[model samples]
Target: MQHLMLVPVLLPLLVAALMMLLGEERHRLKMALNVGSCAALLAVSCLLLLRASHDGAPQAVGVYLPGNWQAPFGIVLALDRLCALMLVLTSLVALAAALFACARWHRVGVHFHVLFQLQLMGLAGAFLTADLFNLFVFFEVTLAASYGLLLHGSGRARVLSGMHYIAINLAASALLLIGVSMLYGITGTLNMADLAQHIPTLRASDRGLLHAAAGILATAFLIKAAVWPLNFWLVPAYSAATAPVAALFALMTKLGVYSILRLWSLLFGDEAGASAQFGSLWLIGAGMLTMAFGAIGMMGSQRLGHLAGYAALLSSGTVLAVAGFGQNLLTAAMLYYLPASTLAISALFLLGDVMDRWRSPVDGADPYEPTSEAAPFLNARLEPTRGFNLDEEEQALVGRPIPAATAFVGLAFLLCTLMLSGLPPLPGFVGKFAMLNALFNPLGLAASAGAQPGLTGWVFVLVLIASGFLALTALVRAGIAHFWTAQGRGPLRVGLAEGVPIGALLLSCVLLTVAAGPALRYAQATADALHAPSGYVQSILGAEPVPSVAAGSTLDETAEATP
Candidate 1:
């Protein structure tokens, strides 16, 4: 059980290695490995979730030892409910994205499979590590692979924008490194579980300095989360990347949210001094503004790619704001929305890319072949094929009459609506319900009352509702501009490879909303664990066993252990 925690991270890497050894020649072997590994990972995640649910435990913490070295002396892998859930979510999205990238990889001769596997490795590592420094190392690994994928096949514009993305992330890396160094210096511990236990004992002055250090680290996270001021890099990077690359924006930003979640409970627990010192209030404000920015940008934007990019920005902000609500709210919001939203958003971005392909006027193989030398892989397809059979589903959705097949498209709109507006039955709706319920408590009510009353909450609410309205409005406007209102719609070709990912992601999205029962329950457990934090600490480090009465009483005479 302890060592099983490493399976999720190890499997993908081993499979990816197998694929890499096959090289660019055996596409069949590579495909089998890619699909097989993801399916396996998904199975692992579901098993983890089941065991987690059955134990009457929020989740068991599994530890993986390398070369049989024990904890404290060697690196370890930790798996709790949150990490397992993320592993599954990341696997699902990566599978879909890999499927979507299949044609391009075959056509262009790029090692899309290799880049993809590395990306999965990074994501799993980020979620599983028990050490803060290792967390940063994994963080860089994923970002680097993501940068490669994002810049793949786009030209100078993407490279130019990706450069900005790199610059911002590199700065963030520096800040994170500094923060970790300060933390280790002060606490004499790098293991998260150990640090959490020791944090409460720091002097008031040391606490203040640590909090200040945390502020710097938090700023770096916000940049990745795409929260307002630090968010400038996000939209540009998304716009410049390929469709499959853009799909990963969801994963990339969630890294930030996950870090914030981990840090808040692990470092700034009740044991750590003040809530004010953690600076979550500022995060909430940033989220509020981010929602508004996305809504407004959606209304004003003309390009589909940019619109999708802005949509990602707003979603990133909401997660941050909701997570900033502290343990109960953060745990609930993350458990509820993170995976579902990642599904929806990744699907939407992929759909946007498909739409671009369908409507584009570029001739045969132009999108696939790299012509430009500057960013050889960065060359983009700008035009649609002349004679292709567009799917009835896509045709009807984009068509003037809005045919019966439009159900999925309509579903997309509703998913976005429920997600952005925070309404009921939907997971986003219920998740927000959890927050609303949490807020109804004395502490919550106080935060609500003090939440800048009119402007802040109202603005967030308006942005939420308006973004939903705007997305629908844009869909309608698009129907008019492309399907019903435009000229070139006789017939278009549809491929199963193209549709499988979209459909799978869509079905899962609906399933998640409909089946929020278990999800919400799991969420509440996470919330409880996060607020009190004994669960997280115990998971990574062996928990304290209940002491026998005589043993407890004799502790006074026993020597206290010192580090």
Candidate 2:
């Protein structure tokens, strides 16, 4: 069971290597391997989550030393509730995106399966690594894979967006390196736990250097998290990518948020004396501004893809602000919002692809008009094609009719809209409500004295409400344009490959709503563990190498202890 921590990082790497050896024509086998690896990853992540949660009375944290050396001297992987939860989320989203890609996107480009698996490996490593250096390595790995994935279909739009994406990320990577090097020079150690243990004892003169390095590091992460002015590249890049790739990219921004949450709490929490909550004010200010920017973008978006992109930014900003609050309850609520928004945005991307196809002109006829043989109740004929095309000019089918696909797309869009907008009966609303409740009652129902939310809290509440309203208004307008105003579209040919993944994502959101009780409890526990990370630090730094027997030791004595 202790060795299970290595599987998430190793399995995808092995599978990717194997897939690389095969010819590109062997796509089916590669697809099978990729999907199988993802499924296995999901299973392993669930076990890790359970173990971290201590449901089986196991340790709450597990540490693995890759080179069999003691901590601070060797590479380390640490798994806790937060890391396990992220692994699970990554696997779930990756699996869905892989399945959706099997319909067409996988074959459109070379090395798709290999890059996909590598991306997963990088994500898992980033979550599991116990040092700042390895985090930088994994960030580069993930970014490299994303560069290829973004250009999978090779359109002018993709090429343009991909270049900008590459340039910005390359700059961020340089900043990350500079920050990490500065920290190492200042502290003499790159291990996160060691840094956490050493930070509070630093001399007053060095504190300025430390904060500068930390700020530089945080700037890189905030750019990835799409916070305000640094986030100009997100919508264009996301909107231009192929659907399945766009869906997978939904988790990429959240990874930035995850890094901020992890490092901020672990290194700068209350235990850090003078450096406690080092940049809370900056985080709050930037996060609120990010929300306002996203809201305005959402209201002005002309495409559903653009809307989904801005919605992601809004979600990131909301979580960042909550993290700034430094309240366990609010953090728990943000955790809930995190996954709900991710699933919704991913579904919206996939559904937007289908909607784009539905609105497209077929057989040179007007896109809005039905053919002579088309009727409201009849099935429209699908023209067999080599594969799905990304261009609007390509004709894939003809005629128009009402079918189950239309109904499915419409209903799924509604759920996504409601979830993104934080409307009733969904996990989005539930998450926001929890945050508001925590803000108004910081004492969590046990205290007799009533409390008032301060000016910052009130401002946060207003931004949250206003973002939701703008999202709702924007989505509702887009929905009307797609579903009501252009009603005569052909029956959408939603393949099982495409429909299943979208349905699964939305259904997961629904399940989240239904199981809010247990989920919230888990989230609250996770948040509590994050805010107080002494256990995590100890587990990482205190891990010891396994005992070895001397060459001259007797077989019986070695067997008795080793096994």
Candidate maximizing TM-score: 2
lDDT tens per residue, model 1, 39-119: 777777778766655665664566665544454546767777777778778878877877776656333536666677777
lDDT of 2 by residue, 1-563 (tens): 88999999999999999998999889999999999998999999999888888743222578899998888989999998789889988999999999999899899899999999999999999999989999999999999999999999898999999999999999999999999999999999999999999899999999999999999999999988989999999999999998989998999999999999999998898888789989987888899999989989999997889998999999999999988877788888999889999999999998898889888754444344544555332223333343433234444343333568878998999999889999988999999999999888856722311123368888999999999999999999999998888845565679999999999999999999999998998898888878787888888888988766763367667788995
Cα-lDDT of candidate 2? 0.88
Clashing pairs in 2: none
Task: Give the alpha-carbon lDDT of every model.
Answer: 0.69, 0.88
What value does the lDDT take at residue 71 in candidate 1? 49
Worst 10 residues of 1 by lDDT: 394-403
Residue 335's lDDT in candidate 1:
73
TM-score of each: 0.82, 0.90
The ten-residue window of minimal lDDT in model 2 covers 445-454
